[model samples]
Target chain A: MKDQKIVIIDYDAGNIQSVKYALERLGITPIVSKEEEVIRNADKVIFPGVGEAAWAMNSLRKNGLDLLIPQLTQPVLGICLGMQLMCESSEESNTKGLGIFPLEVKRFTNERKVPHMGWNQLEKLNGALFKGVVAMEFAYFVHSYYVPVSEDTLASCNYILDFSASLQKNNFYACQFHPEKSGAVGVQILKNFINL
Target chain B: MLSKRIIPCLDVKDGRTVKGVNFVDLRDAGDAVELAAYYAEQGADELVFLDITATHEKRKTLVELVQKVAKELNIPFTVGGGISTPEDVGVLLNAGADKVSINSSAVRNPNLISELASRFGSQCVVVAVDARFAAGKWEVYLNGGRLATGIDLFDWILEAERLGAGEILFTSMNHDGTKNGFANETLAKLSEMVNIPIIASGGAGNREHFADTFIEGKADAALAASVFHFKEIEIPSLKNYLKSKNIPVRI
Candidate 1:
């Protein structure tokens, strides 16, 4: 299991180093690559992103990763902007996403705050990614746009409104928070993803 | 809802923890990595490491220290001091710092803020302002509070936000190490001035001080050094006190 190949999709999105470090701590050496063949053949693929939607999408298209992501049969975990990119589209700069989840990402319009940055509780866990995870467990989040609660949502968190904190559909899984920066509970989530 | 954050600041000099008043008369506290791990266990929302003497050689040591702490701790960590260019920020972030704070550089060349924000998302950039109440107004200070820039605090922070600073770390030079309380009056005003989260630093003496900073100061997070370094206030007890006062904490 330790020798299994895990690939982290690197389309020039931020936070890749932290994800690499997190996997290293878990005793797994993840390959950070932009090659389609490497990502396609890996045991599991981690799509981690942090940056503007348009720019990230542009990079993905440039590297031809936008096409390669949806074709992977292995378990794929998207974090933050990576999760948003999995949706149909985002309100941020009117950018279109990868359309894997068939959900639209919208910006928080309420008067609370823009970024909604901090620790928030994840309730109603309902997928393998959250196995051994208790309800109402806190996870670190930092994002302005969020995917609304939908049938595909595996977990939900409330900031200005209830939003999809984690989504699951078929072999694809995504979390709208930084598990790498989230601490102990986050480590468990990553471990579950590894096992899956 | 996001809980109010309690951040313990560690000032590092020559790879060792140091505590000082008004940014002078530094004294050794302990090893930086050891203290950082202790803070993570104590439920500190986050930890800040400032390389006080960010000399050419010390900068390399700081990067190694950041890697050490990042490997051991599970919580978020921020690194600052003498970060001037995007490459410098890249080095620290690549070393595993969750965020990088820019002080003198941002003030010297305001464009540095946008440069960093563009390369690494705005969430990765923290603009730290060391301000002092001088001549009937708050003025921004640079070089570890040794020089005054004649820049208005409110005006500069507004520009920082416009230029893409994710958060503002406002440290009141006058209230630092006083153990009396925070500069709530100014902090509250600053919080109102910007939509971004403001981290109030300096002058945290007791548990109530944390409450006052959160409630009165309206700061999203409160940062302190001496109080935590001297064990004058324990992180767990301080968080418990804040929780009792109806202030949400991580616990």
Candidate 2:
């Protein structure tokens, strides 16, 4: 079979380079753009971001790509803020997400620390991203908001709470952790996404 | 649980990696990209590139080298040496560096840490300080350990954290390249003084030293050079040993 083309939705999000660089390592030169036709024509899509969820969603809506995203039939992946934005709503910056997954993104309570940085174990798996990986394998995470664990959750990680590490519904897959920074386990996850 | 990280420090001079003992006796090692890739595959959580050659004529060349490494390596890469202002942070970030380590400049202008952190976020700013056991205390050093800044190491570390540094890369000049062990007492003290992750550098000769740095020194990460470069301790084996010692590490 011919290699599948993955399109990374780029609306000036900060993590574009890291995602693109990771994809490139897997022999996939992801086309980073907001062009409707390119995204619609691609075999797969990757929504990557690192910033305030509201601002990022606004950027996506301003470019008219936010509306086009839910319509994609191909497997769509979201990272960090991308994952949070795929939910029903976000407490971070009072953002409304795509609602692909029946989940809510909420800010970390002050009882612990904000911006739960560093590596954490990802338990529970129900998505292609965890295919062929051991349970509770460590993944690099750097986020302050999390999607509360729900029936749609594909994996769970705990920092301040046991929340969804990744969520999947239909052809959509999203991870709160940064696969680009998670080393080999992250590389395998990206590879699984490409295969999917 | 995440594994404690083992990082290999590369001193780049004029776009090439060079190693020395006690910050002198500089000798050629290998290309930065090749070594970084090797270390990454060997299970290094990250790699730190210190532009030991940040002299006037070598600054631009080192930046170019960083871009090259950033392009080829998949692991998180940090660059340090002569970063002074927020603009320098921008230049390195734009060149694809994952993090920028600030030392002398941070001590000179404490606000530079906040400026860089505010602009790029704390995760991007790593405050580094080289210290030596002087006058019954650790003193911060600058200019590759040639000059002393007279800043108390503990006070400077706390100040960096307050200024929004995400991580602190503390190197002990007295133990650097000595291959005896880390300044465990000093590291333990500093580790207690801050909440941000601390990367212990200098004086790593074997696998046990890495565990000691993490366990006894209470460092979040351990960094070395000669041992890794000379094949004294491979990254994977050291991590396995650390794992056996009940220290969390990515294997």
Number of the top-ranking candidate, with TM-score as the measure: 1
Residue-wise C-alpha lDDT for candidate 1, range B60-117, written one tens digit per residue: 8888888888877778889999899999998888888889999999999999999988
Candidate 2 RMSD to the correct structure = 3.6
Instruction: Put down candidate 2 lDDT per residue, B1-251, tens digits, no spaces.
Output: 64577888888889887764232222324677877777788888788898877367778887788778876777788898888888787777767787889888888899999988766777778898899887797888987788987888888888898998888999999999899999888888887877677889989987888888888998888888888777778777887888899998777
Candidate 1: list runs displaced more than 4 Å: B20-29
Cα distance off (Å), candidate 2, residue B228: 1.0
Q: Tens digits of per-residue lDDT for model 2 on A32-133?
A: 889999999999899987766777888888999878999999999999888888888988767789888877788778564345766789898776778888
Q: Fraction of the real A/B interface contacts present in each candidate?
A: 0.46, 0.24
Question: Which one wins on DockQ?
Answer: 1
- Per-residue CA lDDT of model 1 for A124-193, tens digit only, reads 8997888888888778888889999999999999988999999999999999988888888899999999
- Interface C-alpha root-mean-square deviation, candidates in order: 1.5, 2.5
Please give each candidate's TM-score.
0.95, 0.88
lDDT score, candidate 2: 0.82
